[model samples]
Structures are given as structure tokens and as C-alpha cells.
Target: MSQTRFRARTRIVFSLLALSVMAAPAAAQTIVSTYTPLDLENCRHTAGKAEEDSGVWRCAGFGGIPVHVTANDMRMYVSYGGNAKNEPAARETLASFHGEGTSIEWRSERAANGKLKPFATILRFRTSVADGDKTVPGQVLVVTRLAPGPVCRVGYVDGRANPDANALARKIADERARNFRCGTDKAVVEGATGPGFSPPAE
Candidate 1:
């Protein structure tokens, strides 16, 4: 074959290879989840009085990240980044009676380098619902954002109303938690909500 023809064919083959490399889809990010038990009984009391007690507890999180759990007035608040002071202001639901569960679910994104960066948390809360002459028990899954600022509740799924509350909460955390803007983005509430289950004002 002529040298001119061979060189021209080689350039065309290289161009095609470059185009295929550029057109290939990027790898999808993997999501990982880990759970830690919250033992308030073992936590160190920080402040408050009697029934209005407050305290902070440290729990293990994904990738050796420190998880801080703060309890105040029967409500639970959480923060990440190893600093309890990074905890956002209390933004509880309008419920009159509510308390958090003993476990926390951390949802993180796994990077190409095998690093797990937490982006959201799923915590269970038991609330009361007034039904006629008696009060009934109700459960809610609170999805909290972990980064881009102080941790804050980003979404909620009423367990009594949604049978797949856990899946829904995880979905919300994966989709909305990363970019949730504290005090600006209003938390989303799904399924049947009681009079006291209203989301706090942004």
C-alpha cells in the first residue's frame, strides 16, 4: 500500500476511537447505607431541666465519620462533621408529643476511590394523634440532610399512612438531601398527616 493511503487510514481510525471514548457513558455512582444504634441513656447530658432535658451522644457512622445525636424536650436533633455545634436549630414538627427511635440510618455516596460520604439520615419518630376521645400512636420517618450546611430535616414519611415508609424515606434522602437548603427549602411531608404533623415553616 502507498504510504499516503496508510497514513490517511491510520488518522481516520484514531479519530473514530477518540469519538467512541468521548461518547461512552460515565460510570454511575454507588450509594451505600449504614445503621447505628442511638443509646440516649448512655449519652452525656448537656443541659435543660427534668422533663425538658437535653444531651449529646456520639455514634459511629459510615467511613469512620462521627455522628452526633442531640435530644431536647423529647425531640431528637442530629449533626455531622464531628462537631455537635454544627447541629442546626431545632425544626421539629408541630406535633405536641413526639420522641425519636433508638437507631439512625446513614445514607452515603461511594466515590470511585471507595470513600463513603454521608449525605442524609433516616430516623424514626413516634408521635401522637388525637382520635375523638382518645389519643393514638403514630410513627414517622424523618429524612435529614447531612451536608452543604448544618444538618436539617429534609423530608418525612408518615408510617401510619404509607406502608412503604422506609423505602420512601430512603428515596427522599437520596434524591433531595444533598442539595437541601436549610431554612430556605421547605421539608416535604408525604402520606396522611395529622393536625400536628405539619412541617415547620422555612
Candidate 2:
């Protein structure tokens, strides 16, 4: 080939390669899972009004975040942050007539500063399914987002219906938690839902 023709071809090839490199997708961020135990039995309780019949507990959360759990009537509500500004409203409740488990699974990502930033949490709630005249045990996994205004529930998985409830919960957290909008966005419920497995009225 002629010298000029070869030089022109080489320039075009290099330009194409450079453009391709620029258009390539960046590496995805790494996400991780860490666990923190919730001990309602051991946490300090804060007294509320008699009519409310509420018991509140402040528990240790991953990465210095504070977990606030409140039990009112027969239902439980959870919030996370450093103070009241980052917590959910007093009327917020994740489930109806359900009790929560003692363990909390925190889904976080490592920041550039080598700190863990928690984005979501997974907690199990015990519900009841009516059978005959008695009630049988049922479980629901609640996935809650940690930020974007007063951490709120992002999704729920029916443990009895989904064999991989934990995996689904984590998937929901990783996919939806960071961008989930509290109050405005509705929490998603996956798998078969009935009676105690259904989403809360709130």
C-alpha cells in the first residue's frame, strides 16, 4: 500500500478505537451485606402516651447509624438515622398485627473514604395465617431504604410463598433502595399475598 494510504488508514483505526474506549461503560459499584442484631428485649424503652400504648427502642445499627424500632398496638415500625429529622413520621407502620425478628441485615456500599454507607435493611416479620379456627405461622421479609427522606419500606417478600425470600429481599434492596422515594413511592410486594401476607393498610 502507498505510504499516504497506510497513514490515513492507521489514523482512522486509532480514532475508532479511541471512540470505542470513550463510549465503554464504567465499572459497576460494589455492594456488600453486613448484619446487625436487634434485641428489643434488651434495648431501652421510651414511654409514650397511655392511649398510644407504644414502646420505642433505640438499637445499634451498622456504620454508626441508629435504628429506631417502635411497637404500637400489635404492629411494628422501624426508622433509621442519626436523629428525628431522618426518621419516619409517627403514623408510619410497615405491617399490621405483626412482630419483627431479632436480626437485621444491612446492605451497604463502601465509600471512597473506606467507610460503609448503608443503603437498605432487611428484617423478618412474623405474621399469622388463619386456618380452620386456629392461626398458622407466616413470615414476611421487609426491605427498607435508608435514605432520601425518612427511611421507609421499599419492598416486601412473602416468606411462605417465595423459597428464596432472602435473595429476593436483597435484590429489591440493591435495585430500588438508593432511588426509592419515601411517602411518594409505594412499597412493592412480591410473591403470593393473602390475609397476613398482604401489605399493610398504611
Estimate TM-scores for all models.
Answer: 0.72, 0.77
lDDT of 2 by residue, 30-83 (tens): 677899889877777897677666777888888778888877777787878876
Task: State model 2's lDDT.
Answer: 0.78
Residues forming the 10-long window of minimal summed lDDT in candidate 2: 84-93
Reference-based lDDT, each prediction: 0.72, 0.78
lDDT of 1 by residue, 38-147 (tens): 66666554555566666566666656666666666665666665554556634344354677787888898888788778888888878776667887777878888876
**Top lDDT: which candidate number?**
2
66, model 1: CA deviation in Å? Answer: 3.9
Candidate 1 ranges with C-alpha deviation above 4 Å: 1-29, 54-60, 89-94, 192-202
